[model samples]
Target: MKVRKPRLKAVDFFCGGGGMSYGMLEAGINVLAGIDYEPNCKQTYEHNITGAQFIKADVFELQEQELEDKLNLTKNDDNLILIGCSPCQFWSIINTDKTKSTKSANLLIEFTRFVKHFNPGYVVVENVPGVLRQKKESGLEDFIIWLKENDYKVHFEVHNVAEYGVPQSRKRFTLIANRVTDESIDLIKSVERKVTVRDVLGQVNGFPEIKDGHKDKTDFLHTVASISEVNKKRLKKVAKDGGDRLGFANDTELQLACFEGKDNSFKDTFGRLWWDKPSPTITTKFFSISNGRFVHPDEDRALSLREGATLQSFPKEYKFYGTSTSAIARLIGNAVPPQYAKCIGEAIINNHLNAV
Candidate 1:
């Protein structure tokens, strides 16, 4: 008789739009529920993930007992997993506004509340490297100390998702802890090789040529944001394959006033992506050509919603429902690349997924 592996289960914290939860499910784990404060995330999370509920509430307001009552999580249950992949981007990027990040820096602490209440089989965390850099304020240092105090062996490291089969350059910190065994866990790499923009974009990759403000009738998600007449002329001036904003610097009429004297300021902004390389990090502003290197390699417009999601490793079938295009882009941009999350989930399973 063939023996069946015991099913692993998880609860994802800060599960915006179900990206992390979806990846866990794909890794053969049953995601019980996803919790976040954004009410808009509920529909997307519940709609895309099967057998998982979306909890719309602030983690700061949640009590450990309430989570226990709701999920029936047992203390030190080797089959259970707790994931803490909160949104700490504002602090992660040094140039961005730090004031907003301070308010949510303590979210990792709220995640620890559940861990303290129920010392599940494993504790998994994925966040920007800045969290580890700012471990003092992010509560990461204290959390690690607590995990050690509770006899949990941990493995923490910073990894680039592009090295894990994702088509974008994303670096995140990951931590995995297991108390069921004395052996320390190791995060094995994914089987896939690194992918590039050439491997995933263009007409051959199901993304046909679409002009600025052009919306494919069959799929509205493939639409691009419109550009002004002057920006249109600047797009025409750029080189076809991999061009930068300097392509139009000589055009006195087209040169941006803010960059009149500065020759090499924000080199990546308003630039076209290179077809042979992985695209720049897909952020919330990817739909705008003015933000980052979001312009198409050959086309004239910025990336469409579907293009952004695809670059971020979201499956073609995954649908995001929201009030507006920008809202949906926010959902996609803020998401943890599902492929990267799968690697994390699989690593934990390989570590200490004890059979019941």
Candidate 2:
């Protein structure tokens, strides 16, 4: 008679819109529940991910016992897994207005508290690379030390998601810990091939060309942000493949004031992507061409909400709940790309299986 493999159950903390949860599910892990502070994520998380409960609450206020009771988790569950990807705004290099002194600087520490209390068999954390730089303020270094002291074998590194089959060049900090085995585990691996914009979006149909500020009547999320008449003309003059605002650098009237006198620092803004290349990191304001290299390669507009989500490795069928485009963008941009998360989940599962 064949023996059944032990089930691996997981709980996701700071689980924004179920990205990590969805990935873990894809990896054959039974994700029990997701906890997040944002209420807007409730519908999106519960709608797409089956058999998982979405608890809307701040992680700092959540008690370990409450989580244990909520998920019916016991201390003896040998295959229990904990996943936490804390909010990283305060630790992001792009967040210039805020410093490490902000209130959110210590969210990782709060996440560590749960790790200490539950002492799960496995723990996984994903954050921005800036988190490592904020060693003094964010307590990331101390957290790693504590994990080792508590008898958990931990490994962490910065990864470029493009290598993991995501069609975006996003860099992230990832950590994986296990109390089960001493065998070495690696999260980074070479994929079959790097995914490009054409590889993913080339054959997608029904995406009609939309003007600025117009929502597709058939697909609501296929809407584009409003562009000014001047910017519209500027976009028109740009070449289809990998064109940028620098094309008009010689035109004093059309050039931005910052670039008037040999200032070419921000060339990535108002730029179009190359079809054969992976996209630049999809930011929250990806719908605006002025934000980054978000312009459509062949279209005269910035990326639509659906395009942004696709670049972030979200499935086409996944739905997002928000009153406005910006709100939805926040959810998509902040999410750990589901494809990358699946790679990490696979690593964890492989490590566990090898150990057992």
Candidate 3:
């Protein structure tokens, strides 16, 4: 008789829109639940991730015993995996006003509290590269020390998601720890080739050209933001196929005042993407031309919500719910690219579960 393989299960904290859980599920792991504080995420998470329970609460307020009881987790469960990708806005390089993020800066440390209580077999953390450089007050260094002292074998590094088949040039800091064995696990590996914008969006059809702020009549999420008449004309004059705003014919008069008189600071703004290259990192304001190189390579308008979700490796069928365009964009942009998360999940299965 054939023997059944032991089951691997996961619970994701800060599980925005279920991206990480979706990827783990795709990797054949049973994702039991997702926890987050955002009320808007509840519908999106439950709708997309079929079986996983969505718990809407702040991670800091929930006790470890409550979580363990909720998940039916026991100490040192060999198949248990805990994922925590705490809110990174405070630690990201792009966040200019660090002073306002004082509350968010401590969320990573808050995650460590659960780690101590549950003592799961495996733990995974994803965050911005700037997290490594945060001051001692943030508790990142201490977290690492604690993991080591607990007899967990830990490995961490900065990885480019494009290298793992995500169609974006996003770099993130990732750490994987396992207390079951002394052997270190490596999550980063080179793919055969990079996934590109053309590869993912080339054959997508039925995306009607719409101005900014107009939702597609046929598909609500396929809508683009409304563009001003002046910007519309500027987009038409853009060279196309990766052309940038700097290449505009009359920058001083047409461009924003910030770009007057050889002011090329935000050169990527109002720029078109290259078809063959991976897209720039997807952000909440990806639909606006004023934000980064968001213009389509061939089309005259910036990317729609559907296009942004596709670039983030969300399947066509994955549903998103939000109050407005910016809200939906926030859900999509803040998610872990499902493809990259799948790679990390697969590593854990192969390195630890299979080894057992």
Candidate 4:
């Protein structure tokens, strides 16, 4: 006689474009709904994560009953999983203006509201390492202390997603809190080998050469951003498979005023990626060569939208809906690298998500 194992279910908060939800679903967990304030994500989330409903509402404005009505969640269900991978721009270590992120800094505390109300069996959060670095100011410390006081056996650590099946060098902070049982709880384990850019890119991986700004007819998203005349000449001078700004350090004519005085701070800007290594972290500005090592190794253009999404470990079939390139780039850059999320989900399920 075969006894069916009950499936673990989850609700994803701040689920941008369904990345986390999609991964959990792939790992055999039922993600009931993904909630977010951005209406731009609704279409993509609804289209991709079939079984999950996309609830467009601000976390601050959202009520407990609304989730109850939408997800049909019962209070104190030891099998229920709550995911709060909030947008962490506020806590990100990037040198962007802190004033812009000031308003959203307290989002982690807001996620705690639902955690207290539902008392879910499992709680998961993935964010930038800066969150833990600035735990006191980011509300991470308070949240961890509260979860511990509430009987949650918590495990947290920062890990590189490249070691977990994602072909990029992305370091993220992960926290898993479980109250269902006190027996055991552990952080997600990594893969035996790393996946690198060479393993996924090039003609063998379906990324054949296309000119800068060339748009593939079959998939519009498989297109690169157009560069200016001056930038085109600069890219042509770069070597394949790991060319960098240093190549033009002595080229007085093509060098920009910013780097002329030997001030080479953001040297990665306009750099080509190494074919053999994992790519640098993909960010919201991945479409711009002026952002990071975003230029293609074999091509002269910055990474196409699809390529950026691929490095983020999103399924090639995953459809992202946005009006413009920047909009779509933001959607792809701000994802959890579905592969890493799947690892987290697998860790929980394999641990059996014990009963209360």
Q: Give the per-residue lDDT of model 4 (tens digit) for 258-314.
A: 887764678888899999888999999999999999999878999999899899988
lDDT of 3 by residue, 1-356 (tens): 55665778999999999889999998888999999999999999999887999998888798998988887889878789989998888888894777776788899889999888888889999988888877376678898899999999899888999999898999998999988776877876647789898887744544556556767644337877888889987888777878888666475557666677654577788899899999999988898888889998887788999989989999877888888888999999999999989998998888765454
Query: What local distance difference test score does each model get?
Result: 0.85, 0.85, 0.85, 0.87
Model 4 spans with C-alpha error above 4 angstroms: 1-3, 353-356
TM-score of each: 0.95, 0.94, 0.94, 0.96
Residue 258, model 4: lDDT of: 86
Q: Can you write out model 1's per-residue Cα lDDT over 1-356, one digit (the tens) per residue?
A: 55665688999999999888988988889999999999989998998899898887789898888888898777778888899989876557737877766667888988999998888988899888988998887889999999999899988999888888889988889898988778777666664667888888888988878889876444337867889999999888878777988888888999999888776987666798888878888888899988888999998999998999999999988888887778988999889999988887887777654423
Clashing pairs in 3: 212-225, 212-226, 212-227, 213-225, 213-226
Q: Could you tell me which 10 consecutive residues in candidate 4 have the lowest summed lDDT? A: 182-191
Q: Which sections of candidate 2 miss by over 4 Å?
A: 1-3, 99-101, 188-190, 202-206, 217-220
Model 1 residue pairs with clashes: none
Rank candidates by TM-score, best first. 4, 1, 2, 3
Candidate 3 shows a clash count of: 5
Candidate 3 at 254: error in angstroms? 0.2
Kindly provide the TM-score of model 1 when superposed on the true structure, using C-alpha atoms: 0.95
How many pairs of residues collide in model 2?
Answer: 0
